[model samples]
Target: MTTASEPRTSTGVPLPPAATDQPPAPPGPAAPPQGPPAGTAAGTAPGTAPLRALLGYARPHRAVLLGTLLVVLVASASGLVQPLVAQHVLATLGSGGSVVGPIVLLGVLVVLGAGLTGLQSWWQQRTSERVVRQVRRDLVFRLIRLRVPELDSRPPGDLIARVTSDSTLLQSAATEGLVLVANGALSVVGAVVLMGVVNLELLAVTLGVMVVVGVVIMLVLPRIREAVARGQQSVGAVGAALDRTLGAARTVKANGAELRETGTAGDAIESSYQAGLLAARYVAMVKILSGVSIQAAFLSVLGVGGALVASGHLTAPALIAFLLYVFYLASPIGSLIAGAGMLQQGLGAVGRIEQVKQMAVEEDVDDASPVAVRTHSTAPAVEFDDVQFSYAGRAQALRGVTYTVGGGTQTALVGLSGAGKTTMFALLQRFYEPTAGQIRIGGVDIATLPRSEVRRRIAYVEQESPVMAGTIEDNLRYSSIGATDEDIAEALRVTRLDALIERLPDGLRTQVGTRGVQLSGGERQRLAIARALLRKPEVLLLDEATAQLDARNEQALRDAVDQAGRRCTVILIAHRLSTVTAADQIVVLEHGRVRALGTHQELVDNDELYRELAASQMLVGEDGDPVEDLAPVS
Candidate 1:
């Protein structure tokens, strides 16, 4: 919603980072072990219910995840079988029985468990890739569909970060975290149960040690979740910084601000580094707790089991089996801790991703009937009926502006900067909604029509003449996908781009580098005009279309436009009095209001502002001499 009168930065600031070095954004609430869908559980966006958001992603891939979980369970069961087989081998040897059968069974179980572990690895990795892909796709769709106002509200860099870095965090969380929590819990239960059957005295001592560590772990987990959330926020900040700096690269270099700009990005990068350290610190704490719990329990069980064996309370094979179960118990506990950490990290990303999803997108009706094309005729082809409008949180850009242009005629808007001329074009294009009043095309209210339907009948060339990254032909057919080669040549010939196209080695296929930097300003302007003309729209809106052209090219384009004006309604905003002097009608805008409505000759005679602008452009003076013959005015 930035107007020509205001610098774009004046209208809106870039989105701020949620966390900084000094004060971090607090982590969201702890996630449920079995989270629900992101939007359903909280009836809100993803970040607030991050666990649910994660589950929502996994939900779509539930069959794959369940498959992965099953493999993990089978692998854990294979592992659990090893300790029992080893105990049998010991018992057989002690009984002086044939030990070969037990020994061979133990070796076979070891190989099967290894093979399942490898299979589980493949499943987890594959499932993680799929989850990340879906997350990125969802983010990309939301980003592209975001309304202009939403785009204006945030930096493009931070939005991109959601697709890149943030989505990556969700990959493992959806798959690995699921396997760890589910299989680990089951494995831990199975190991504890088997250990209890072998010796209750050893099991009791081990459980007591684990309870102390578990309580301590619960107390510290919330901090890890908070740290991870802040870390991801800082990474987003880094992206925002780079985007801002790189977008204005020329300006930064022109101002000799390379160091300063780099420092700005560096500051964000440093913040991310600090956050990374904080997250790692919390993760290390969890690992230490998990590792310490195992060691403590092992030592306590070993000492107690040894004493029991001495007292004949526990047999040798039973103590050996109980101890083996204690060591096996460590693997699942570590998995649970790792899974919890990954879930915390994924939850951190949910808030930023959800923030983007919450923004409103432009509504387009897919089933609405296409608007009928209007042919040449004398009627009010376009009308602004007491139209009132304003930018978000800004003063009115248009104030009860009322006017009408006849079909098959050209109407020019002549105004000083900030007089609402461009804003009129924006309103016509449905980029913004009017606060009050109606704008009609061919006597039909545009508001009642779908935005896409309305745009299909009108062609607009903006003042900036933006060119996207692509080949020349690619940009030409962008608006009208069905435009033929003959239509392209005709449009180019009209805008005087045909000669340039012919001179190029690649002709129409020439590459226009990023933002069309490979082309001159006038060439880009002509290219924009040609693209619009190719649409052959019912109504054409041009904003300073000839601003960059030399007199000869401008005159050629003017004649071309004049010829086309015979078959369609054309509304153009121009600061150059010469561009609109011969128009069928001219609307004078001043301070968001229509100050005058007349032909250029009529205005020069009747309105002082019109006369001044005409004189400034050397189109007219009091004596009305040709521009070159005119004497200098004080």
Candidate 2:
């Protein structure tokens, strides 16, 4: 193994000193702060900003929302008529008149109220679903378009939570919260007015009690919003933890670390449970407070109204009607408080969702029109001029390095593992931009072009030969959707994968399983090569493409490389020197700079580092073992 102190490649290039003191940063996006922002703190109410933003999401469905509001009003009116009908019945009985007509009217009002309530509920639910669906769709679109750096910082599970759970909160808040709050406020106002007409003293007493209770609820409301926000964050943490474990399920199982993984996931799950408990505690407090306020108001009304009735200041029927209105106040008051709570929860979710929306997103590209490859080119196809790059929390990976690879020629890049070989490939594909300097493709500065256009002309096959979970044919056609069956067959034949297909029971339809576990390493590598070939790109990048192949498969890969070189510029990185001996040119890199550039024969004769590599393998002894060391070059 290469150690930090004495980093050396097979080609004898020395690596930079390692900063082993600091642990390397994990790959992917930078992680955000552990907690929500200060604006989402526990003391803060679900403010106008969140509510206003939420309304923006609901704007598209405003027409439906308006209709639902009308339905709610009709329902509220039906509910109000029942109490008056009861009052009429009580008055008729007191006057010694027939009560049958008033009693029948009361029953009819009850039926009408029930029917209207159900219809209102149906419309409200439908509107909520539509709003949620649209919110989720918009979130998804923004998530996918986020810039690479932003994406790297966020966990996949947390993002999924935003799309699923966070959006669900908006559903309840948009329809139920808005509609209930509206109808409840209207009913409360109506009740207050009717109660005043019956008895002003009783109405004043009830309002006084409600005012005190409302103040208490307002104090507790902000706390509920805070707890709910934390709960949702905890839920996101659970999702992120599960995603981490499942994505590497095989590795955990193989290492017998299942218990450890489960423990880690359990911690996240426990956290979510605790947060939920906190939110529930606050919600319960709100419910108890609302109930107590209503009970207190009822007792006060009954005591005061009874004295007035006995004193003959109020009639028995008016007292009864006033008591009914006092009871009516309970429904709307409870509903209003509940709706407020739901709105607070949704506002918390909105904060999280809005954070994602505010992140930087990549510019849209016109994939319909790609940069056309030059049919006739005498100039170099790829060039790097004084390029430099540094990844986060690390020393520079590439120094001021410059080189040119001619069109339709095979150039092999040989370097130490940390000598920026992979970094070079990344720059070529514009997966990252150089911190300094320029890169040109086909005599055009790639910086001036869209990422999509730059990538359109090049085909890159990574060293790992990653395969998606799909059938053989699906993986093959991934890069080239328009590729014909004959085109696929030709690529398979060139990469010598035709025989594997013939032997499989399902031929091209054979499933590769997850990450192509069903295929051997060599087969996966060749499959990647075949996929790239089908693109017919102007430039082909093979990063240790034949690393897993045996001697026979390696030879077949060499043939494929030669054939590919005839039509496109081929640049490959390889550790095995023998495989690249026939390359048109070899560029050796050391410490992120070009150490030597020449053909196999020329480098072996003159370059000491090249000679050492050749002696390690090709320059064998008479006993068929490699020589220990060759004489130093003069």
Candidate 3:
């Protein structure tokens, strides 16, 4: 629906992490066993899901992960030699060893470090891409398995954000952040030990300063996790708003509500901005606190070493070497802070990701279960016995509404808008299990049948008859994936669209555009009928297929319906009596119950409602008799 003329809103937020020592606990209900769970609180504690989950994906690539880790560890340990070597050169120069040798050694170390760093980057990124691909695969598979009803209430943009933005964050954290945490921890420990080897007094001063930094970090980190989680949520909200506004861009322009939609989207963007700023503020605080602590620790070491050297208790060479090791601690310490922040952000993302994952997906029916056949030699029937349903409470959409479609017949369902014609379809699809009911497709209860098998036995043409973005040929092939080209042609021909298709340059190959926008109302309905025809289903459910068509279009649809009735059980919901006059049986519905059931002639003669509908159609003659112009029943 979006176009260049539509008012666009900004929803992007810079993805950033807070530098802290700890992350908050994971919140919300547990994710379903595959990914993160649904209903889990927004923010999650550090390590709640476990690095082990990463290993679960990594298990297949253990050799690669282990090899990559070894190389990275070697590179990190090798890089550690730089400061010590520089200190050694300083001492050698003080004792007058040739400057060329030390300078050449330093150059060698730099080249080696650069080469190792490059290798580490390549390996980590490769492993990360593989792991992310696996996660995305699992996520997509699980998403598809979720029932349609669950998706109906969710925002398309939010789902996109999870797969694209949220997943990317997790990938970065796994590869880069994990490496930093591991190497940084090693560097800190190694430096500490090296410092102890050089001078206990200096090491003690460094440890004391680190303790202060740790305490400050603990106080600041939890807030950062909360802010990061909220910021991401705000971004998702903004994306959702923008998605909605853009989806209805044509409607907005037609109504001159561009400004109003933009304002609504803008509100979402503003909330994202505020959340980003809040997270940034906390990240800045952590950065400042860590920087100040590192600086103080340096000054304290310098001061103590200066006094020791002046008092002749510490050698000039030893003090310089010890100080160099202390400086080495800085890089790892800074990395640790950065890694902590990434950890917090990753945890937040996991919590959000799990929200969808935790929802219970519909279980697959056993392949051996009995199939629900909708057609029998005796009767073409659709029946509901003791049906009961509720979405969230006792407010039932359908309650014990029972009916039947006689054999080789067409049944028209009539009622007020909410009288539950649609609810009947929902039950037929098994989208949600009934609280209690037996829906017999023919003589067999649908619940006892395998879900897929039951669905395969029936053909559903929805109200809108939605068509995808593919070509007309592709659309027809959707109902029966293994159908041949001739099968598709036959379906098109049967629906009376073959002549129309031949007029277009590309015919069946013509793109339908998104949701089949290029086609008229009649064309879309015919396309749906063509799709259903390909399946050669035993039972057909047409929901208001002709409600919105013009006269010509309605006649075309009527022809198609007539063709369908020859070989299948047809159940239709239509407001027009003309569409049902030829039907073998017409069931009148009101307030979720059948009020009348008979052939068109029989109903007109016996039922007051049927007589009123027929009389109002202007088909009745002057003498209060049925008109001679009435179309003959098929």
How much is 578 displaced in model 1, in angstroms? 2.0
lDDT of 2: 0.77
Query: What TM-score, computed on C-alpha atoms, does each candidate reach?
Result: 0.89, 0.87, 0.85
Which pairs in model 2 have colliding backbones?
Answer: 29-152, 29-153, 30-152, 30-153
Candidate 2: tens digits of C-alpha lDDT, residues 53-72: 87787788888777877777
Candidate 2 lDDT score at position 45? 43
> Model 1, 385-446: lDDT tens per residue?
99987665556778899999988899999888778887788778776677788899988888
Candidate 3 has its poorest 10 consecutive residues by lDDT at 15-24
For model 2, the run of ten residues with the poorest summed lDDT: 1-10
**Model 1 residue 54 distance off true place after TM-score fit, in angstroms:** 1.2
Decoy 1 TM-score against native: 0.89
Winning model by TM-score: 1
Q: Could you tell me the lDDT of residue 449 within candidate 3?
A: 71
How many clashes (backbone N, Cα, C below 3 Å) per candidate?
Answer: 0, 4, 21
